[model samples]
Target: MVDAYLSLGSNIGERETQLQLAIEQLNMTPGIRVKRVSLIYETKPVGYVDQPDFLNLCVSIETNLPPFQLLQACLEIETRLHRVRKERWGPRTIDIDILLYGKSIIEDEHLSIPHPRMSERAFVMIPLNDIASDVIEPRSNKLIRTLVQPDDSVVKYK
Candidate 1:
């Protein structure tokens, strides 16, 4: 199985519950096993500053499925959670982003592994550091712990 990391966030409805529900659905999917999860953090919205603060967390999983299939599975979970894509970075019930997939670097129309903007978002990096601080991001060949986290407000909520 390939080790993968997922970033889950929500700002509408029950935010923390949305993340938990997404994790549950990911675990329920075939060829995937939820391994470790970071502390849920409350973070201010990034792109769309006018939305509610988001509850974000990182998830480590072992999956036998390939990248695209894994992306599909994540998309399915988001859909089940009533996510709407009316605007980019807009408020949503749930958002699941593929942060890392094994040691591979992937750049495709549908997705990008080692999520292109992970390093820029403390909401993703801080939680990533919690579970896999020493893990190297293939793109940079540097330890994830060494990557700088944005100076944004992130509070442990759970």
Candidate 2:
């Protein structure tokens, strides 16, 4: 089994509930095992910022699925949650991203492991530090906590 990290976010329809439901779905996936989860944070939205604030958290899982296969599973979970993506980075009921795949550096049309933008987002960094502060970003070779910058602040949701 490989240790993988996934980032979850939601900005629509009971945001925290959406995140919890996503985690539930992930834990139920055949090849995935939910190992650790960080505290949910209320975060300011990024990219297209006109939407509602999001509830975000990071999850660590043990999975036997390949990177692409795992990516497919995440997408499936989002779809199962009735996610509608009419715009780029638009608000959604659930968004699950493959942040790290057992230190694997993957760059493909369908996915990018270590999530190209994870370091720059407080929503990702704060929770990532909670669970995997020692884990390094594959490309940067630096701890995930070290990459955090204070552009945005995140608050504990519970």
Candidate 3:
């Protein structure tokens, strides 16, 4: 099995419930085992500022599926949860991103493993650090804890 990290967020109706439901669906998928999950966090929206704040967290999983397959699974989960990708960086019922896929580096028209912005997004970094402090950015080869500033405005919800 390969280790992977996923970042999940919701900014629309029943945000926390959407996150929990997504986790439940992930757990139900065959060949995917939900291992560790960071505490949920409340943070302001990143790109599109006019929407509601987001509830975000990261999950660590051991999966037998390959990177693209895992991405497909995540997309399916989002669709099931009522996600509508009408606008770039817009609010949604659920948004899930593959933050890291073991040590793999993949660049294709559809996906980029070790998500391109994992290092720069506090919502991704904070919860990720909670689960895997020593995790490193594949491209930069720097520990995530070292690359992210500590003062980012992410706070645990529970």
Candidate 4:
């Protein structure tokens, strides 16, 4: 099984419930095991600030699925949670991103591993640091702890 990290966020109705449900669903998926989860955090929206603040957390899992398959699984979870991708960075019921997939470097038209923007987002980094601070960026080969953004928006919500 490949170790993977995922970022979960919600900015719309019942945000906390959405996040918790997503975690439960991910755990129920075959070939996927949810191992560790960071405390939920509240952060201002990154790209689009006009929307509501987001509740975010990071989860570590072990999965046997390939990258695309993993992406598909995330998409499925979003769909089930009533996510509507009407606009880029728009408010949603839930958003799940594959932050890292073991040590593999993947670049494809549909998805990219090591999540291209993870290092720059405090929401992603703060929670990630909770579970895997030693994880190395596949492209830069730097430990995640060194790449943590100095933004003050991310804070433990619980």
Candidate 5:
């Protein structure tokens, strides 16, 4: 199975519960097994500033599914938790993003492994550092820990 990392966030009703349910669903998927999860962090909305603060965390998983298939599974989980993509970076019950897929660098119309913007988002990097600090991000050829930076907008969720 390929080792993969995913970032999950929620800002709608019961934000923390939404994240938990998504994790449960991911673990329930036949080809996926969650290996570790970071402590949840509360982060201010990034792109769309009008939304509520989000509960964010990252997970490391071992999965046999291909990148696209894994993306499909994440999307499926979001839908199950009532995610509505009315706008980019809009409020949602749950948002799951594929951050890294093994040591692979992938760029396709449907998905981008090592997630295109992960390096720039402290919200993604901080929690990712918790679970996969030494994991190399293929595109940058740098360790996850090296890529993380302090950001006031992100803090541990109580």
Candidate 6:
């Protein structure tokens, strides 16, 4: 199985429940096994600023599926959870992003591993550091822990 990391966030409906159910869905998928999950953090919205605060967390999974298939599974889970794509970085019931896929570097028309912007987002970095601090981020060749700094905008969710 290949080790992969995912970041999940929700700002609509029961936020925490959304995150939990997403975790359950991921675990139930055929080739994916949810391993470690970081503590949920409540963070301010990034792109569109006017939405409700989001509940964010990162997850580590072992999956036999390839990167594209893994991405498909995440999208399927989001659709099942009622995520709507109405705007760029818009609010949603749940958002699942594939952050890393076993040191793989992929740049396709539909997907980008290492998530392109993950290093710049505190919401993704903080929680990711919780579980995979020592994992090397291929692009920067630096530890996940060293690439991030605590931000005032992200706080531990209850």
Q: Better model by lDDT, 1 or 6?
A: 6
Comparison by TM-score, 1 against 3, better one: 1
Backbone clashes per model, in order? 0, 0, 0, 0, 0, 0
Between which residue pairs do clashes occur in model 4? none
**lDDT by candidate, in order shown:** 0.92, 0.90, 0.91, 0.93, 0.94, 0.96
Ranking by lDDT: 6, 5, 4, 1, 3, 2
TM-score of every model versus the real structure: 0.97, 0.95, 0.96, 0.97, 0.98, 0.98
Error of 4 at 88 (Å): 0.1
Give a tens-digit lDDT track for model 6, residues 1-158. 99999999999999999999999999999999999999999998988999999999999999999999999999999999999999998999999999999999999999999899999899999999999999999988999989998798899997
lDDT by residue for model 4 over 47-141, one digit each (tens)?
A: 77899999999999999999899899999999999999999999999999999999998998899988999888899999999899998978899
Clash pairs for candidate 1:
none
- Using TM-score as the measure, name the better of candidate 3 and candidate 4: 4
Which regions of candidate 5 are displaced past 4 Å? none
Candidate 5 residue lDDT tens string, 1-158: 99999999999999988999999999999899999999999989988899899999999999999999999999999999999889998999999999999999888988988799999999999999999999999988989999999998899996
lDDT (Cα) of model 1: 0.92
Q: Which ten residues in a row have the lowest lDDT in candidate 4?
A: 148-157
Instruction: Give the higher-TM-score candidate: 3 or 5.
Output: 5
RMSD of 5: 0.6
Q: RMSD in Å for candidate 3, one decimal?
A: 1.0
- Tens digit of lDDT per residue, candidate 2, span 1-158? 99999989999988888888999999999999999999988988888999998999999999999999999899999999999989998989999998999879988888887798887778888888889988888899998778876544798989
Q: Pick the candidate with the highest lDDT.
A: 6
